[model samples]
Target chain A: MKYRGKVVVTLKSGVFDPQGVTIKNALHSLSFESVEEVKTGKFFEVLFDAENDAEAEKLLEAMCHQLLANPIIEDFDFSLEKVK
Target chain B: MKYRGKVVVTLKSGVFDPQGVTIKNALHSLSFESVEEVKTGKFFEVLFDAENDAEAEKLLEAMCHQLLANPIIEDFDFSLEKVK
Candidate 1:
């Protein structure tokens, strides 16, 4: 079966997010004073083939651990659905 | 009132994603042969204060137009929820 996956990878809490900070500062400069904070991360959409749901889930887990996220500093989560 | 927003910014169709291509190739090299394609984007979580839902939505829309996305090459979508 074919599957589609959406994955979100975010830095672990307590990790400094320079990009987010820069964006927040820029927003403030733009007169968006009410903005309090901003945090940024990565999103991935994957299309692949697998034998079944279990296999697809396994593949996604491995892919996230090995490539999509830096397990040491980032946390990743994903959802999958079968594709026609 | 306070609100939390989650934004996703993705390249418009036909735009080349070099990072996604690199990751796809790397996955294939890692023996995840069933992988067919990959696309990557950006995610942002924002915490802010707004007078009401309408104001919060407008603020998020402007932020995306001005800084969160490249209007020419990318599209952005976001969801906002009230925060305590």
Candidate 2:
């Protein structure tokens, strides 16, 4: 079976997010007075072949660990759906 | 009311995505022979106060248009869940 997945890779807590902070500042400048915070991350849409759900999950995990995310500064999570 | 929202910003189709291509090549290098494609985008987690769902959606839309994404090269979509 083929599977489609989305992976969200985010900075772990306490990591400095200059982009997020800049975005927050921009929101404030836009006069959104109640804006609290903004955190930014990466999102990926991947399509690949797998035999079953377990196979897909394992491949996704390896992909996340090896390439999609930087383990030192980022943490990753994902969801998969069978596509045909 | 306060609401939390997630925004996804993606490069429009046909826009050159060097980053995505580079990542795909890396996956191929890892022996993921069946890898088809990889598309990369941005994810944002935002917290802010709004009077209601309509208000929150409106604010989120404006944020995406004005700041979170570039209208020229990217398209953005979002979802909101009321938080407290």
Candidate 3:
């Protein structure tokens, strides 16, 4: 079975992101007067051939925890879907 | 009303992403023999004060279409929620 998974890795709350802050300031300047703050993260879609949903999920979790996400200060969330 | 919106911007199908490909190669080297391809994007959460959900969505769309997403080759989607 082929597995297509989408993972989002974001900084934990209270972790200051200079890049996010910069974008927030830019948003404010763009006339989004009401815009207050912003949190930014990376979104990735990984496609792999797995045995099944359970096997795919195990690989997906390992991938995120090992390489896709920085476990020190970031939190990762993902969803698994079977792709042809 | 205050609004919190999350936006995801991803490359259109058929678009080639070298970064994503590199990541895919890395995954392959990590013993993910079944790994095939990867597509990556950006995720952003924007906070704003708006009159209501309708107004907030309008602004959110504008942001995604105008600034948050690269209209040339990327697609954006967002969800809005009320915040204190």
Candidate 4:
């Protein structure tokens, strides 16, 4: 079976997020005064073969740990779905 | 009232995705043979004040168009939720 998966990798709380700060400043300069903060992260979608949804989930977790995210500085979460 | 929102900006289908290709190659080198393709995108989380969910959605759309995303090469989708 083929599975589609999405991984969202975000900076762990307390990590310095300069990119986010830059964007927030830009937003304010643009007059989005209501906006409080902006946090930026990485999103990845993958296509892979798996035995089932469970297998796909397992693979995605491995991918996150191994390559998709830097666990030392980031936290990751993901969702997997069977695809036609 | 405050709203929490998420924006996902992805390269449109058929657009060149070099980051994705480089990651896919890395995954293969790591021996994830079943993996077919990988796509990379940007994720953003925002906190902002709004009159209601409707207003939040409108603001998020504008943010994407004006600052958060480059519409010429990317497509964006977002969800907004009321935050207590």
User: By lDDT, who's the top model here?
Assistant: 1
Clashes of 3: 0
Q: Provide per-model DockQ scores.
A: 0.91, 0.86, 0.86, 0.92
Task: Output per-candidate TM-scores for chain A, rounded to 2 decimals.
Answer: 0.94, 0.97, 0.95, 0.96
Model 4's CAPRI class is high
lDDT digits (tens) for residues B1-84 of candidate 4: 999899999999999999999999999998888999999999999999988778888888998999999989999999888887
lDDT for model 3: 0.89
Worst 10 residues of 4 chain B by lDDT: B51-60
Tens-digit lDDT string for candidate 2 (B2-76): 899999899999999888888889999999877888999999999999998999999999989989999999999
**lDDT leaderboard ranking:** 1, 2, 4, 3
Tens-digit per-residue lDDT, B1-84, candidate 1: 999999999999999999999999999999999999999999999999999999999999999999999999999989999997
**What is the C-alpha local distance difference test score of each model?**
0.95, 0.92, 0.89, 0.92
Q: In model 2, what is the error at residue B79, expressed in angstroms?
A: 1.3
Model 2 share of native interface contacts: 0.84
Q: Which wins on TM-score, candidate 1 or candidate 4?
A: 4
Superposed model 1: Cα runs more than 4 Å off:
none
- Residue B73 lDDT (model 3): 93
Q: Evaluate model 4: give its lDDT.
A: 0.92
TM-score of 1: 0.96
Using lDDT as the measure, name the better of candidate 2 and candidate 3.
2
